[model samples]
Target: MAEGTRRELFTILETSSADADTVPDGGETPVNLSMDVRWFEIPFREPEEDEEQDEEDGERENGCRSAGGAEDTAGGRCDIILVTGNGIKHEEEHPEEERYYSVSYNCSDDSDIDFSDMEEEEHASCFGLDGDSEEEEDCASPHFWGEPDQVISIEPFSVLSGPQHSLGSDADTRDYFRLLFPDSLFEHMVEQTNSYALYRQRRSGKSDPHWHPTDLREMKAYMGLNILMGVNQLPDVDMYWASDIFIGNAGFKKTMTARRFEKLTQNLHLCDRESEPVRGERGYDGLYKIRALLDVTENTMWDSYTPKRCLTIGQGAVAAKGRFCPTQYMPSKPLKKGLRVWMLCDSRSGYCHRARIYVGRASEDATVTALAYRVVTSLVRGLEGKHHHLFMDSFFTSVPLMQRLLRDGLYACGPTEPGRRGYPEVLRPCNVGKLSPGEFYQCQRGNLVATVTRDSKVVSCLSSNSAPGLVGIGPDQEQQGEGDDNWTDTPEEGGVSFGVPRPLPLLLYQENMRGVDLCDQLRDCYPVGRPCKKWWRYFLWFYVNICIVNAYVILRESRGSVPPGGCNGKHFTQRHFRVRLAQQLIGDYQGARGMERAARKRHADSPIEYGHRLERMSERSRRCRNCTNKGLRHESVFGCKICNVHLCRGGCFSEFHK
Candidate 1:
């Protein structure tokens, strides 16, 4: 090894490491080990005359590239290096015999070895120092490296367990509802609400006359009214008890007074306000007001139903127009400004199994990808090792995250951004733009595969659960083909077709990624949300609506099947289920009427004399007010014309005017 000269070496080995101890003594014959011989070319060549002139002028090239640029017409001389293993005898008399070379121990200095002139196929020879004989060829390739005998094996997902409950056709709406809002939860709400009211009274030195300590039954009735309001909505809460004949609902008036409902709504509390940490404190929580409710709801959901194999992780927005620190502004979401919540839901049923409120960033130094990783890991905590296949979006998919999930025995697939770290450079969006529609380029490292496919747009995806290849038309595509002739398997020359081939991972993602969105859709229908100054109230209503949706889902699953028409020959939609649930919650409980109802009645009675007259009614009959007051079960086909009130005919009508 001279200062400026390159030496080309060829190495050979007579025996494998395992067979080294059985080498025979030098006497009889030397083993011809040509098949076991390994070659390595390390060049140590002399520089040209121009280089010597440049060296004299203080402009010398210091790297192997400069030395390799010189011509080598006459083949560089080769030197054979020998490796002698433990218990193996070497004889100097057989100098012409093929020798063993272990480049790992023999290459003492590599500063003088120039590799720039080596051919592409000879790159494998450079990694001889890696010392892995079996994987020697695989190490030569730039994109992949591992044991040569390694195989890709993905574990198949199997359902080891599911929802464990005895709920069957015997379960009613109340039973289903109770699963999510247990009696214990109602009692807890009662205790917290009372304590909060007492704390407020003590701080202000004035007691609220309307605020009486609420009981479990009253809480149930209050929640029932909220659910009813979502079903039969009105602009104002008092309108439910309005004296207007067209607008008022008698059922609401009988269930509870409008004043009592208002009182409960104003004083609702999930936790004691006094126990909350002050703002700017180290242990302060932005969602403290709703923390207890969120925790209980999430735990109940997890216990009520076990999610199926396919699960989706995504973010949903709970609309809140208020001054809150944790509120986020996502312009892309339908609800532009609101609180963001991360949810893990069952893909098939859209039932939410877990939810977490996004209260800003966890710390100042956390990056977006780091926050996403933490959210996913936290949501899927108990689900690990269950062989569940999780689907997510670009926000949560990354090479490292997918690899980490595969290690945990969880399968994951999602659309990934091309620029993410560790993504294969060969399958970058720019590099794969030339692929035809339905065609793709993929690179696999172990079980994780990164694919770039051409669809309407260039899409890049990473998946640990699905193999990399194009799949035939799926069920959804087949349905589309039925409606449009252009969706046929073979398209006409110039016709635009929707039947393009899709990568297996993309197909799975398309089919299962709507779980969170579906949950959001269900929650949005007939929403119980109302305008409130307190931000936590919005979150309260959000969870309440979600509970109803989840309860309905469980009821459907438990029942297994609905009769031909429905339960009792009526189409049982969610609206019907909610109506029944509210009725059960109200039950036979009765509360005293507020003073405002009595005054409104007195006022109405005063206006009765304006132009009172009995008038015949058409269409449906109503319960006669005069007969009901007198404890008679009489129907009315007539009412007072001026007062627009329904009453029994003859004696009953005349007596109402008096």
Candidate 2:
């Protein structure tokens, strides 16, 4: 059976090979090979006859279509057993045929799947700072800032006025004024002195701060107005253009006196020392009728301010060579002033010191110093137990002066001038009711012996009792008993304690230590002191600039920055509005500098002229020869450069400036 199958399959292959000329199909062959053909039994899945299957798969001669039978392809799973059958051609109906095998395959394109269109969602979200994740429940939010080390690095900046300065309107600067001053700051200065002067000038009958004077009488008031505005920002400010102030250069000599001061209320008056001429009282120190002018303000047209105390001092002007007739009481007045009214010369105090030896105007240093001493003089009444400061250098450090301050119930502290005497050489130990000796040693003020001989005796002396057996080398380096410098030798037959004759320092002790060290140490014990560093002045300048800038900001509006509603609401200007912020700015910078000096110089020549006027007081005014020639001859120029006008620089220039 196997031999027959093999012979049949081999015959089909041999038939094809023997006839190489058969072109059975239209397809052409590219290359041809004629060779022997042998058919191995290849199993077919459709059960084709073995010979027919071998014929379908027989080798082509020149161009034959059949290689493996078309139906001979495997149907199901087929596994061919190579039992060394005579040929591969096989027919099988049975699943287990010896020459048959089973094979199966899925009809797929066998193509590779491309992931190019895989459609992955785009990446999102940053790397997490929010701690809201469930796994991060214990974690705190990460910080991006607020770390300590990042803040303090110095950044260099080129600072200057920016372009916004030009854009700054009167409205803007006015708001700045409100931001700076507020009512509280003004009230603070008001509690000190009651000398406030404000002038009103109306354009279209509407008053503005920029108002200037137009008349001779009002012009004098304007001068006073200008004076106050000038010094409002000084080291120790007392006067202001539109508020009450103390009348002084803020000198150390100022003493506080609480008396009912006369309200001028639009009335002008001279001091009692400057009364009407006594036919020969003019031109003398008692002759230049010092007066006060009051401008009445109608708050509700019902409130009237009356002059409370006015005392006549000396009759007749110094121009007429007048002498003060002594009096102890002041004149009482209930009189209110009308517009342009003038009160006769009257003094605020019964006894007065004449400026006979001094030249025209008061000096800043001398005046401020005098004011300070005056404060010390009145300490018992004005200061009580409260601390008071008396800032001073060594120039005023006299031992008697310090002792005098202590006697007045005020503490004393200050730097000492060099080469002076009466300082501590006594390191007397503390005893009795005084500090313990060890405690006294702990005091760092000084360690010299004999600072106060017999510390207990000194303590008793401080309690208003005179101490015995205590003496020292005086300021003159003489014995303690040697001093007319302590008190005047005007012997009154009455035995009264003027004061103990304490030694006065001729010159203060120059600092052996630093000025600041001395000042700090002294401050711990007393009220007066001085800074000792070379850079102290620089420190002072720093403080001064802050003061100046603050002053400039507050007072900037006083220079007419406040318009009715205050340049009212950004852009509107009303009755009280002024448009020139730059004018105010520039003026604030220059800010009436040297105005006092200039004013002083302006009046320096007046004293000589005043002397001449006083000498001729009895003569004639020529125009008002019979009308009491005491009337002021307005002699100066109070001019407004903008308006091109002038008014009296003296006398009653009050109403005119308004």
Candidate 3:
């Protein structure tokens, strides 16, 4: 080798030695193999006098030549070296028989190489640098690394699609939704309403005597009467007496004292458990307890006068403000932090058939369309297939919702958003509002129709069942003269032309959509509800008041149909009805226990145990003044020394005390 090429090779070997020492073992002892194949190459070359000169010329042309650097050695090139850590001298005495040292580089086609049996190490050996020396080798020459194994395959094409059968998919969702809803919704609503009373009865049966109310049923009646009689100005205790025992603002001596009234009302029990702080048990902590009463009352009202045809879905607000209050929008004022109730009522009698409190959206996936559908379906559950017409406001009106109702055999009509799917595009507000007043345009698609009328401004309504029939001249049209620009001049008949000019759909909506409003007006007459920390209490009172209204309506209808000398001979106002009801309820269990005077006397005369006892009075034994007041002078044998009064066992005992 030339002097400069020899120095360059030595310098490369020295740098490789330094790099090998710094390379980490990765916490493992790696097998070290050191081989030099240059000696084999040199030994096989023919010894020629001018061979050294040829090598020197080739080295000068390639700049710095290495085993893998020259393009002539690019194919199948690898330096073949074998240096075992176990010291063993190779028997190289027979060159042709020495298999380990006989290097072979196969440059032929490798179409039949078996790559399956090739280990990762064997593959690495084929392509990796074969020796520590940085020199290019010509594997295409007779002595070099073998060719590598290749792999090739063609894959067939496949199409990807959505699930054919999956849970909660659109195809499976309807049945799942049915499971979430009540099967017999009418019975479910009625059962919820009556659950409280049934629970109270069960609880009272198991409760201790101390937990019993003075009169459970009577106390409920008295509470109802107090609401109708009005006691907003009176103290809580005074309310009890003013509603039942007391007459006007009479002196205390004429009626039950305020202290006695307080004592009676305090013992009222609707549930068995004691107050929470006293017993350390949850006691009526949620709306569950009172909700039953409200629900039952509404159900009873519905049963008494079921709405047969038209019903309206409308919202009613309960004014409440607190962190716990559900946020509900109010069109009349600023955002009201309160609860809303969607009520369905009879169009003619204003009877509330069904109502649901807006607890929140049904779920995270709930949208405006979904909520409206849920409310409408829940309220009109049993009425499906009856072809009952339901009227609603814009908040709940939508094309899909109406289509679903029609599919269920119901007719729905209300003002809906123009952007709602299935709403006719030609009936857009701008397109239809170009007509003069009383001039209307309508578009019908299948069973659904959209009507646009330009009255004060523009009004659009969608109806699944109603049609835009012939327009008739209304009273307003009559007020406008024949020369009015909006009305076309038609031939007058007998100096007058009068025909209904109002759109039929608008007329029907005006008539049928007032059910909810009428129900609200009736409830407003005497709200009987008091401010409560718990929002549901207001609904409880509201349901009770409406029940009374429904009863009044039934009574009026029945009386109006009565012939001369009918059963309902006397007419009574709602207030009179409430007064009579209170009297009857209290009278049923009037004399269950003793009054204040009897208890006081018993305390004062403690040693006189036999002061009062049950004894029958004869016709002439003694004239009891209590009996004389009733036009009966029979002697009242039942007399108490403590109270120092005479009384008949049958009526006077309960009458005087209650």
Candidate 4:
């Protein structure tokens, strides 16, 4: 053969190398595996071609070796070289044929391969699924998580549809909602109102009340249920008229002067009435009557009762509670509307922007008086005998107003600054001297009842029979029989009085006790007035305001539509879920309706097509399983009768139809 340049031959292997510890090395010979590799051209020599040997023997066997031949071969006469000229030793003893085991492994290079760990020019937007590796080329393509935001698209479905067995999906709220909503609760409201009435009757000893001022003043001469409550109940609030204890205000911008209010009629619209400077008395009766009308819508039914045929209404309101300036009122004679209509307006303000439309027996005009009557509609119909306290401030604490309150079967009391003067003499000095200096307007004076010195006014009063008493419950009156016997009976009490008055009644009667916290007292209220909004923030402010004003304002923004039980945080999640479910239902309806337009829409968005696809998919899924089941084994007539889907006994044979 002609001589040619030599080329090198080497073997490259891909193997699962055994860890260093897996290999046995008793002597600890140095083994290096990660050495750098370099490529080079080297001279190689071809071995002489060995001819195939023809077997003269009958069987294939090992080389014939005589005793003499072994010695001859050991002398290095054989030329199958085991040592290289590079001084590297080669294995002289090769693997025995019997020890050899062949293992065949087949795997695709790309299968289960994690490209995330590979070294490559990563194009995040590119799917890398196709042969094309350019991201710019696929810029027009829609991909999940590629846009600014992404939302999972689910086809519309109804909770009520399908099987009733799957109600657990939204069971946390739906069941309770159905029970606690309009249906059951409507009737329940009437029941609760009646119960409240019964409670009020037992608490107030006067089963029947006289609206006459003369009767009220005469009653005050003697101890009323309020004076008795404090001595009856221990550690109870000294409550009298609910209004006296409750903080209340009316946020009204005097739009129409008092004269305009006196002559108010259906002909005068709230908007048509000028924004009369409310700086002077705008006739309090008209405005007040209007307020009352608005409040009574839910509670009263004025069809039957009539002691006072002519009741004056009051009015005036600001849009928001940001700016407040207290204004006085004058009752212009007696203007009556058994269920009269007067235009009461809430002026342009922030609160009005948020104010919702509240209707009560819609009359020609909606006013405060209308609201008041509406508030009592259900109460009057359900529980006519309930007594309510109509507390007021020095502003409305005139003896005459108290008489008016008595006419309505409501106990009236407030800080009698200058107006009220026909109450019985009280024990304690006026605590809030800042309100009215030295003179008291409604303190009890002997049995005849005198609106005496403010300094001598009772600090607090209660109404419940269970409330504590004044004289019977001193710190020394412990339960021991000795403490009980030591107590002296008063001749006024006939000396045969039950030495221990009922605590609840006594609590309501303790006019001698410390005055209540103005803020805390208004915890229960239908707010009437409020300070401006610029002055407050957060729920604390709202709560504080609610506590301060007996104005009867509904907390609308802070807590939207208080649940049946009010703003209870415990039901927060449930309420939220209810809202979500409602939103879902609405959205589904809209989508379904839009599709109708989509069918007609020539240039509808992709979402429309997606909706159609979803509808088709839903239709397919709802097909029968037993009769003509698409993905089912052959069956006779056991298919889903309603949906016409093929189903089997083994797979949900008892599914809901429709």
Candidate 5:
């Protein structure tokens, strides 16, 4: 080999000693290993001389040459040694190049390898691996291929055990029905509905006859009717009671007067409670009872309608004005006031999987770690053993949470704090400006992986399931730097521009994080909630609307009907669905209230009438069907020539005609 090209020789020691595995006692001398080896040589070259070397010289010098001259003093190989104690000896092989030698001890040798060794720089040298070959090998190893470093330098997260089973198949037609209507959910609802049974047991014979006690069946129906009416948004009780309006046909017994309706609403209760009549208290000391009812109903909805695939956590703001309103912060009014709620919703259907009201930091000891763990775990509690992916904002994502979730068989991806402890410093935002738009840095420690990409803005994310892969870029219209004026000149190609490339993590984040916002948008349209003095009443209305929205989503999917103009369906909008639900609930109670009366009455069409035929008819005073049914009286003025029925002239002349 060329003198300058061959630098350092690496020795491979093969041993036949049985005591090679044992370590010596601490107060000791370095152990000597006697080993036999077949010497191997790898080609190497100095950086400056590499360009000038001939290719023909490299091909002929492929194998080790026998030791010769002062340069090859050890037969082109050195004796292998094992060292112990603090000041172990190492040979100075080259005076020009700095070297650090790592010893691999597989055997104890009797031949001592001297550390007080030196070789002149001009002497013939041994060859080892070249830089290009070493780098290519390292890049191909999957263990630490794209990572900045091989070790997790920060404090490690507390990881849990893996789940015993896997998530269900990825097919859309998989058995998701059981999740939507579990038997446990039904059992809980039944228990809640029958809670009023305790009140009946306490009744005494001395109670007033006028004290209309609540029945479980009747209470449920009354609650259903109230939800229905709320959706319809009647101006007042009088409008619902109007005989001419369609709402008047909402079912009850014929004896159900306006007074009875008012009484039913005022006395409604889900369960009996201990009487503590304090003045000015909301619900007259029944607030606790109502709150309990809300809690049970909301939980039942969650259990009964579990979301299938991707879950997202987002915040919602409900406007309120009262001393009772909880102190909370929203992006719109951070210093001002509103009620805040954290919602976990399904990305596809926009159905809320779970929700929790956010009180101030005092109530929950609100650190980011504790809050994130609670919110994510509670929302995905029923999803154990199912490897669902969770998406969230920066407020609730951390390395520790990602590790915990992955161990519990759930995967999560979201923007998180790059500077937080345990996060890889290489993925920090401060290092992002050095990267171009399509470039990113990735690092992995165990199952947790962190990625930072430079898009229009720097995005840092931690994911357990996804890798830092690139899918493609978004359309040019969405690019931040472009303008409409730039695209207008391109007449033949239409006003379009190519988009910037996007990484997979940023794309997934954008797609999955809008679930809660979708829910907010749906509820905002045709809102059923009205202004109320009591705070809990707003929650009552809000939940009722959410249930309806969930039901509508299910119905749309099951019915398989396409709506025009981007409405829900051809025949049914959300309002129409609400009206139909109200009608069904009330109708099931007693057929629509005035339906039977209206059906039995004789009538004539305005544009088309029955043929006229003159026949002798009775002149006696008989009741007019329309007036008699509505509790009005009129004598017969003339007989209909067609059907021989009597009718009054002034109002009933055209009412029953020819």
Candidate 6:
């Protein structure tokens, strides 16, 4: 062999031998004889002329010639020999098998080894040494973590198609609210309520004589009273009808009697109990009692308004103290023990577009990612091909989910937990502390980008819709900076300052992920919810609050301009809208007073002894009660002195008395 190549081989073997000796006892001993010594030649004895000719021919056929030709082999085949620390010898007859010798060394322990002496071909040949070696090569390749600083393409958002309905200038608060809760739903409620009352009466075999079947008008009035109760809260339900000068709400007494309102509340039903499936039946539903109401409300929300480009997916809790199978306990949440609901809402207006009640986990082993995927997919079912960007939290963000959303033409951005699957190993929590405040590291896989940034603390985010780069603080943060003297452009010790670099995905998540929270805020402002023994009642009130918030948002948007007086303006705020809506819903609907009150009024009037006497009415004529009951609007100027009420002077007075 050549002297130069021989010296290099000897140097590598000596170094490997020294390294092997330093290995601790009972520890892994790896001898790295990494070199370009493929074939070697050593002269053991002289050969005959016939043998020399035969060796040259064999070398040519085998393509294993030594560096200086067949003369270096001393007219014989060359063989490579390697000796281990334990005096074991490994001899290779073929030069092609030399790579196998390198494979025997533990590649994991070669972190400090320099590969500069090895050719590109030799480095490439070491792929089979260890799986991690191949992974290291991949990590060094360009675009291995996807193209650096890649920007996601943004699609122009537009409402392509939805229910077409327009409100004119003459529209009232009731008109706007009916867009979300129409008259048909009220009729369905009335039907189910009357049926349930009849069923109860039959089962008891004794019907109360005071019970009267409710119609659509009375049911609407009943709903109106419920809404008004939210605005004028009292300690007890009957207090709204109290006749005391200090605490009485006369409007409640004017609309419906306390007894009748209580009766309607007791019999209120959204679905027929007789048709409910048995507990162990195949088609049993946990929410069957309020299923119709939920369906109608959800369908109406989708049909009423189209959401904007940015959306949010989150969970909400409806407080309840009833026996429910799907109640979850979340000590961190405000409504710690209650029913859970998943919601998808608009970021700009906080309008709920879709919702799903959490019944329970589908199975015991169901993963968190799987449940989040199902919820996001189910809520955004009809919104495909619309290019809506969704923001969520770590419970819902995962690498596979982001990829799936990208494939569906949807986009998502959110913070992710470090331990979540497919998170970049280079951006781990341990490395986060090494980054300076406002500094970030990102890795991309196709459209999905996983980013870790150091702010107040280490925050990791995964996104399919945002670019991977630093951005300045947002406008809201700038506003906050004005009040706080500590806010500045300069960085602090292990913390971020105002107007510093922030990850784009983190910014987007912060800006657009509060839709559900905003919805909760609006619902909590004048909460219509109250504690109830029935679990479905809590859900019913929750959906009602959602509908009211959504309706108010729609009304504000449809108006195109805010009134001058802020919340005090007519139909400006949710409070004004709800009050006006309740008034219109209760228009002209009256309930019968109790028999005691009627007899007391009769006894008080009988002592006057002014029976059947006619008296002239004052200003404008009122509608005759007898005529209005017959669907006629006959005005009356004459009044009965005995009754002290307006009536026609003829048979109408005698008919009202009868």
Candidate 5 wrong stretches, greater than 4 Å: 1-265, 275-299, 302-306, 318-321, 325-327, 332-338, 359-366, 430-439, 454-456, 469-471, 477-492, 562-573, 588-658
lDDT of 3 at 342: 86
Residue-level lDDT of model 2, residues 145-168, one tens digit each, is 111111011111112211112223
Q: What value does the lDDT take at residue 212 in candidate 3? A: 27
Give me the displacement of residue 346 in model 4, in angstroms: 24
Residue lDDT tens for model 4, 312-383: 112222123333222222243122111111211111101110111222334642643334444333222321
Please give the range of 10 consecutive residues that has the lowest summed lDDT in model 2: 146-155
RMSD of each: 17.8, 47.3, 36.0, 46.3, 20.0, 20.6
Q: On TM-score, who's better, 1 or 2?
A: 1
**How accurate locally is residue 120 in candidate 1, as Cα lDDT from 0 to 100?**
25
Q: Write the per-residue lDDT of candidate 3 for residues 546-604, one digit (tens) a residue.
A: 66566555554444533223125354555555544444433443323335445453332
Model 1: per-residue Cα lDDT at residue 321: 70
Q: Could you tell me the TM-score of candidate 4?
A: 0.22
Worst 10 residues of 4 by lDDT: 346-355
Clashes of each: 10, 95, 19, 138, 4, 0
**Model 5 C-alpha lDDT per residue in residues 297-386, reported as the tens digit of each score:** 566556555455567887776666566636465664332466677888876568777777665443474577677678777767877655
lDDT of each: 0.63, 0.23, 0.45, 0.23, 0.48, 0.63
Q: Name model 1 segments beyond 4 Å from true.
A: 1-152, 474-498, 563-567, 594-658
- Which pairs of residues collide in candidate 5? 32-109, 33-108, 33-109, 34-109
Worst 10 residues of 6 by lDDT: 98-107
TM-score of each: 0.68, 0.20, 0.50, 0.22, 0.52, 0.66
Q: Residues 181-271, candidate 1: write the lDDT tens digits.
A: 7887789889998898888789899988666788999889888888888899899887887756577777776776667778777778888
- Candidate 3, run of 10 with poorest lDDT: 35-44
Candidate 2 structure, TM-score to reference: 0.20
